[model samples]
Each structure stands twice: as C-alpha cells, then as structure tokens.
Target: MKQQNNTKTALIYAVDLLAIRPYSTQQLITKLKRKEYAPEEIQEAINRLTARHYLDDTDLCQRQYQAYINEKHRSIKAIKYKLMEKGFSQSDIQNAQEETDIDEIDYEYTVCLRLLNSRYIPSKSDKLKCQGYLYRKGFNYSAIRLAIEDFFYNP
Candidate 1:
C-alpha cells in the first residue's frame, strides 16, 4: 500500500510537469529522481505515462524539431545537440530528421542568408566577422562562403 501510494504521487507529479511541457522519458526520470523519488517509483510513473499515451518521445522529438527549424531557425548541428540535451537518442533524432525531410545544405544556405541580411550585413564592412558569426551558429565553411557571396553579389 505504501509503495502504491508513492507510485501514485510520483505519477501525479510527473503529470503536473508534463502539463507544463513535454518531457523525454529520460528527462522525466531525471527530474523525478531529483525530487527524491525512488527509482522504482519513477519508473512506474514513467511506464504509466507511456502506457496512457501521455508521454511519447517520438512525438516530442518531431514537435521540437519543427519548432527549432521553423521558429528558432537553428542550424542542423545545433538542433541535433539540443535534441540530444533533451534526452533524445541518436536513432530518435535521425528518425525525426528523416520524417522532417530536412535538406542540410539548403537549410544552411537559407539560414546563413537570413542571418546575413537580418543580423550581419556585408555592407557593414565586417565580412570576416559575419562569417565567424555564422560559423559559431553551426554553419559549415562552404555554406557560409556561398551565403556571403550570394548576399554581396545579389544585393
């Protein structure tokens, strides 16, 4: 009876957290552990959430991927790291990428262009600085070069 009560409490806490935002299984487990819940209780809560369809890592990955791409405009590498930090496995991340049909080169070019035009204009006489900024944003050398060329030549 005591163990069952603990499990129920843990499940309620987990549900409350999920009501705020989605969490990966690992993330939720970590959070529950930090709350001093027993590992078995945490696992039980997670299992219940999963069984009830209240927790789906794949769906979370897909939603996060779309948000990063469409809203944050993050580079693929950056997004990958973010997903990893959020407790997504490499296989899950890869699956999300495949489902999203992201074209790396095109995405980099577009992001670079947007960054150049909006944040780092070539007309500022800081072409190298602009390149460095894009590099820090996880764009590759080739994509940065092409974006710079496209910006200066076309504009």
Candidate 2:
C-alpha cells in the first residue's frame, strides 16, 4: 500500500511536469528521482507518460532546439552540448538539428559583432575582462578574433 501511494504521487508529479512542458525521458527520470521516488517508480512514471505520448522525446528536442536557435543562435557544437545537458540523446538532437539551417555563420557573426560592441570596447582597459565575457558567451575563438579585427578595420 505504501508503494502504491508512492507510485500515485510520482504519477501526479509526472503529470504536472508534462502539463507544463514536454520533458525528455531522462529529464523526467531525474526530476522524479529528485522528488524522492525510487528508481523503479520513476521509471514507471516515465514509461506511463511516454506510452501516452505526453512525453515525446522528438517533440521535446524539436521545441528546445528551435528555442535555442531563435534565442542563442548557437553553433552546432554548442547546441549539441545544450541538448545533451537537457538530457536529450545524440540521435534525437541530430534529427531535430536537421530542421535547422546551417551555413548561417555570417548571421551569427553579425550578431556576435553587435554583442561585442556593446559589451567589449576597444578601451585599453580590461582586455582580459572583455575576452572572458565573450568566451563565456560561447563565441568561438576564431569568431571572436574575426569580429574584433573587422570591427576595428571597418572603423
């Protein structure tokens, strides 16, 4: 009876989360585990949700990848890292990634330039600090170097 109660609670928890947003199976499992459900119970809740199509990995990945693209304009490498962090499988990310455009480097570079202009100045002050800021933003070394070089060259 105690076990039955836990299962019901876990199920409720899963339902609430699914109602709010689609979650990868791994994400749901981790969340359920953190809520103190046993591994088996977590698995059961995830299985139930998946069977009902309330938690589709493909759909979740698609939504997340689209958001990432729209918001961050992250590189494939960075985007893959994000999806992995969000508990999506490589194949799932790969499939979703196909829906995105590649060869968008120029657009990203322009966005990077705007970001750098606001955050990083040509001031003799705080070169390291500015570098660190862009690095943290996940701009590749080449992208940063080129953007900064072109920034000054065009000025």
Best by lDDT: 1
| Tens digits of per-residue lDDT for model 2, 1-155 | 12444445788988998788777888888877777777777778778888888888888898888887777556546777989998998888999888777545664566567766765556553555655665777777776666776665563
Candidate 1 lDDT by residue in tens digits, 14-94: 999999988999899988877778778788898999999999999899889888888647788999999999999898899
In model 2, where do residues sit more than 4 Å from their true spots?
1-7, 73-75, 123-136
lDDT of 1 at 120: 58
Query: In candidate 1, what residue range of length 10 has the lowest lDDT sum?
Result: 1-10
lDDT of model 1 at residue 63? 86
Poorest lDDT segment (10 consecutive residues) of candidate 2: 1-10
Positional deviation of 102 in candidate 1, in angstroms? 3.1
Q: Counting only residues 3 or more apart in sequence or on different chains, how many pairs clash (N, Cα, C under 3 Å) in candidate 2?
A: 0
